[model samples]
Target: MRRRNVLRACLILLAASQLPSPAQAEQIIRMSTTYTTADSGLLAYLLPMFEKRTGAEVKVVITGTGKALELAKHGEVDVSLTHARPAEDKLVAEGYGVKRHDVMYNDFILVGPANDPAGIKGGKDVIAAMKKIIAGKARFVSRGDNSGTDLIEKAYWKQIGDRPQAPAYISAGAGMGEALTMAADKEAYALTDRATFAAYKAKTGLVVAVEGDPKMFNPYGIIAVNPAKYPGVNYKGATQLIDWITSDEGQRAIAAFRVAGQQVFFPSAKVGR
Candidate 1:
């Protein structure tokens, strides 16, 4: 009977040893985010800290802003971080997202070859610079991926009332990094977020041709997928991530993220949230 008892205890201990440990059972939250955020290395810098604190890992889906929001809408991700305020607001209004919390911001800038084919170098007026590019028939690379940068570029062309013709206008239908590479290869002008441009500048050798336009202000927001709509979604984890990202520590992390010694992203989270 003592041997039987010892055997039962050994069996129980073996079963327990085979089960997953608490640390091995860490929760995973699916996050869909813009290409710029990932390409700029912000996630690499920030996510580990959050994971260490909460023991919840973030699985990032890197895509354009439009697709990022679409992932949230389709219940494919627990949360989304994207730029383009109008689209973000629309997602929240459509009940796909719980709420939109301001995260950070970086402006869009026109970048082109060092020779400045369009003659709009150092220009503050993005609209006028775009006009000059069109008028000069300079090759312009378009993301055409429906990204936040792409949407902003289309808006600029809409305001200009004309866009470059084909051959002069090349739609890459790719991410920011690839589009920038295409621009560099073609020696064409491209609109890009400052953070991504800073990250890729050395590799692409593209110079900023236009910047400092009020219309170029690009802000990012994080939204938790609505639990009411997608009951299976990790809404708790999503909210935890949203809250932590908008918190003081996350804001400071955003402020501290730099590319090539330049502060690329500015924290825009409201205080007391």
Candidate 2:
């Protein structure tokens, strides 16, 4: 009987060892997002709460909106959050994404050195401001990475039918934060989302050079990659994050987030998808 009891205990231990470990069983979802969302400290502020509530971990890949959507297109990520609306619609229309949910919004602003070499400070017209920069041949830093901000900047130049010449137009080919730092370092003008500008305001010493332009309105959206296209993706986990982020609680949290003692992103979740 003693031998039998010992054998039984050993069997129990072997069975336990065969079971999956806690970490291995834990749910995880991969997300690709814009640099602005990450740099503005929004993800850092909200992701922890999500992990605690759902017992799931979110692996984030930070990149420009264009690249973020590209990752989703390849099914490399379970979800994507980006600021380019037209691109987001295209992704869904092409059936790469399940659906798009309105996440939040913030306006883009033109920022430059305090001295305002372009003489565009306090202007509400972005095109007018760009014209001033071109007229003065003021150094203008550009992300030049085909990012959403870059697209907008290029569009403004297209609208004006002019751009700063090569020497004056510095294509940093970097992210928003880095472009802003480059702008500051070069005492140049650059267009940026307000949230990132707010976060880097003190560090960059770049003041808002132009704002309040209706054309500068920027909106963000979140979409889960289609599981049909990528069977390996964690669709259930992605849906959980999507539903949670658009829920009332999540919208409230977004609304409450602030930088430099001022709210930067405003919640715009319609709350159903």
Winning model by lDDT: 1
Over 4 Å off, model 1: 1-26
Candidate 2 structure, TM-score to reference: 0.90
TM-score of each: 0.91, 0.90
lDDT of 2 by residue, 1-273 (tens): 999999999999999999857565438789999889888899999999999999899999998889999999999999999999999999999999999999899999999999998888989999999999999999999999888898889899999999999899999988999999999999999999999999999999989989999999999999999988988788888899988888999999999999988999999988654
The candidate maximizing TM-score is 1
lDDT measured at residue 100 in model 1 versus the true structure, 0 to 100: 93
lDDT of 1 by residue, 155-223 (tens): 999988999999999999999999999999999999999998999999999999998999899999999
Error of 2 at 137 (Å): 0.3
Candidate 1 Cα deviation (angstroms), residue 202:
1.0
Question: What is the TM-score of candidate 1?
Answer: 0.91
For model 2, the superposed segments whose C-alpha errors exceed 4 Å read 1-26
